[model samples]
Target chain A: MHEWTIADNLVRLVGEAARKEGLTEVSEVYVKVGVLRQVIPETLKTAFSHLIGEIEFAGAELKIEKIPLAVKCRDCGSKKAGDDLAFTCGRCGGIDLEILAGDELYLDYLEGKGNGE
Target chain B: MKIAIKEDILKEEDRIGAENRREFLARGVAAFNLIGSPGSGKTSLIEAAYRELGGELAIGVIEGDLASDKDTVRLRNLGLPALQINTGRGCHLSPLMIKKALPEIDLAALDILIIENVGNLVCPVSFDLGETAKIGLISVAEGDDKPTKYPLLFREAEVVVLNKIDLVPHSDFDREAFYSGLRAINPAIGVIEISCRTGEGVEEWGSWLRERVSSPAGR
Candidate 1:
């Protein structure tokens, strides 16, 4: 599934950090995923499991937080939680909304001193 | 051993892409990432562009595909700095590939660098290559509901070229619906109806291209 592909991205992120900073292993990885990104987390974790061995990120834990679809209505200027992909203002009929959150894909940090390879 | 470091991985990709864009802009060169589906007439449009402004404008192409360099050959035969990027089985082109290929491009002398992305509407919209404008190509035969079905790509595009209009008569689709759908997603987007085969609206696209590629910001 595309979820596994998403995990590959996470693993790649961690692997890159590990390789560049000169680490033998990674301990933890934190990510923020927004709902609007249309990505599934379980598949990403599964992909991470396989890719962990490539850069000595084996045994590293992946922590992710899902960001809700928060949008700002253009007409009312009120920020609200969007129900789904099709965003509309709940307070007003304004359909012009800006996404405030939930399209996030970031690697917050890494923790570990990998043995010198 | 436990070592804690703070980083954002997505930022890294964006940073690299931003850096590349900065470098081009610094030298007064602008780049466009061209995207669309197979047989959407991207190569044809490129050829038409070559005919119109290829003489006055200094253009280069980075063609991305899973296997063939046929498009690359076509572009090269016309005597331009054209390169082919074979992605093997990859569905889309990444900024990393562009970074690797930048060395072959002389940004100082060129007016435009067009990256013809793999022929897919879905995956390519997600990646940013530090392009100044994303030119979304959609043929009339592909169905006018495309804008509604692929809102992400339409939203990402600065200009949407409804190419291959000559075949519109043979297809059952609503052109107005396509425009309205796109406007619903993005009102400010520039829409041009063109047919590369008959040179219809090619001048309009080329004229718009000339203005952008010849601006002070562009080399």
Candidate 2:
């Protein structure tokens, strides 16, 4: 599954962040996943746990924040957060819409014990 | 202690993709990533393009499949410079794969490079392979609801190639519904309907390729 691929990237990013922060043990990792990405939270969590099990951040809590799809209509200039995949403007019935968010996949922050703590 | 690290998970991949873009620009090669579902006529469209524009443009291909080099062999049989990447269990082709394949091809000798991604809609759309444009291919047999079902692919693709148009009459494929779905996701996406088997719209597809190769913008 693509979850494995995403988890691999997440591990690398987390490792790099840990190194920069001098974290000997990471306790929690916060990530933002967009709804448009179609990523299953449960699957991603499983993948993340599987990948981090043997690392220094083995027991780190993977916290995921799902971001809803937000778009701005070019015709009516209306901003809307949509749950469905219609992708149409809610107010103006326009198809020309600019995506404002919800396509993101990123690590927001992390909490951990650093060196000499 | 808390460490603030707001970073895109695919930052490294994007960085490599940017490097690939620069390399393509330096070589003056218009590269296009062709993505579609299995049995959506991706290989056939490549063959059709080879037949139509092979003589006019120096076209090279990079075929990405799970475990076979059948597509690479097919293109090689036609005497096209082709390379194949077997992703094994990977569902999509990553920028790293593209980076490795780049050295195998003589970039300076080609005007166009077409990377045929693994036959997957969801995973491949998220990964950029440093191509000039991403082409989403859907056939009439796949139903008109594809754009709505897989919005990201349609939203990200520069153009959507509707292949197997000859089967439109045989199947109950609604063209208006398809266009409406595409419009909702990507209003400005260029659409070219073609039947590779019958060569119905190969000329238009070839012209689109030619324009992309000739234009400095490579839109």
Candidate 3:
């Protein structure tokens, strides 16, 4: 839903990192997105592509790592993928659960070369 | 070379949210984020609360919608301080919007600030607006399957308000199923049944709200 805002922040962060490292080009930006974010990958890529130029990273590509939903059963202490958005424990059939993942939206790294020409 | 830049995507928004929280705390203002589906009686609930508890508490509202000042007008007609934010096509209200709207409100004069979020259950839950409490509304007309379908919103909210209880007899709403579904998602969530039209259970809701506003836990 807010892919544009996420993309804008991604560009700002990558630009900041590039500036700090004295890099002229950011070839790729790796991001980890959890399932709960509900961000469309194509929309995020488009937003990133549109804004990358303003941050002086014209040819940078956005790489997204889709993280599946993972939850832990509070009763049995078993962890598994939360399929169908049920979130209930698979083994114990318990409603008491703790979410271990699937809400993350963060920038992992940027791959590029320093000014060496 | 790989340069590690592990940063949350909503870092900027969170920063703004923290600022808003600090401001609210400093002013001793109890802020609430009111979220619900479209036509789920969010405005009606606010109006009902104001009618019942206006003498005891001064309420201000920040109304968010896709593209209308209609709700803002409705609140202002009651002589209450209200600010309308038209997001155009945006799905949710961000912390920046709250930060900007703070200047329009006299934080010192207000005891409670209700930020009525844009109508949508899914997108609004993800964005934190630095509210003291997150209250969700579900009308009986919306069906009891809402909690099952949108578990995240139900799970995250501190209070789930079941509005339009006055029409329960006319509709096909299964109250037991609704409660069961909500309990499945959140065992301790406070569900207050109220009808803005009939004023049923509005006093109980008001008392619960006043307790939150006066208590340190809500801060």
Per prediction, fnat is: 0.36, 0.79, 0.61
TM-score of chain B of each: 0.92, 0.97, 0.96
Query: Which ranking of candidates, highest lDDT first?
Result: 2, 3, 1
Q: Tell me each candidate's TM-score.
A: 0.82, 0.95, 0.91
Give the Å error, residue B50, model 2.
0.8
Candidate 3 TM-score versus the reference: 0.91
Q: Write the per-residue lDDT of candidate 2 for residues B145-198, one digit (tens) a residue.
A: 999989989988888999999998899999999998898777778999999999
Mark the regions of model 3 whose C-alpha exceeds 4 Å error after superposition.
A74-76, A87-96, B216-219
Model 2 scores a C-alpha lDDT of 0.89
Chain A only: list TM-scores of all candidates: 0.84, 0.94, 0.93
Q: In TM-score terms, which candidate is top?
A: 2
Ranking by DockQ: 2, 3, 1
- Show the lowest summed lDDT stretch of 10 residues, model 3 chain A: A81-90
Query: Could you give candidate 3's per-residue lDDT for residues A1-117 as a string of tens digits?
Result: 678778877888888888999998889999999877777799999989999977678989999998888889899999987544665677988878888998889999999989883
Return the clash pairs for model 1, or none.
A3-A43, A7-A44, A24-A114, A25-A114, A34-A102, A108-B7, A111-B3, A112-B3, B28-B219
Task: Pick the winner on DockQ between candidates 2 and 3.
Answer: 2
Give the runs in model 2 whose Cα sits over 4 Å from its true position. A115-117, B216-219
Better of 1 and 2 by DockQ: 2
List, residue by residue over B106-207, the lDDT tens digit for candidate 1: 878788888899998877777778888889999998999887777778777888999988888888878888877777666667898999988899999998
RMSD of each: 4.1, 1.6, 2.3
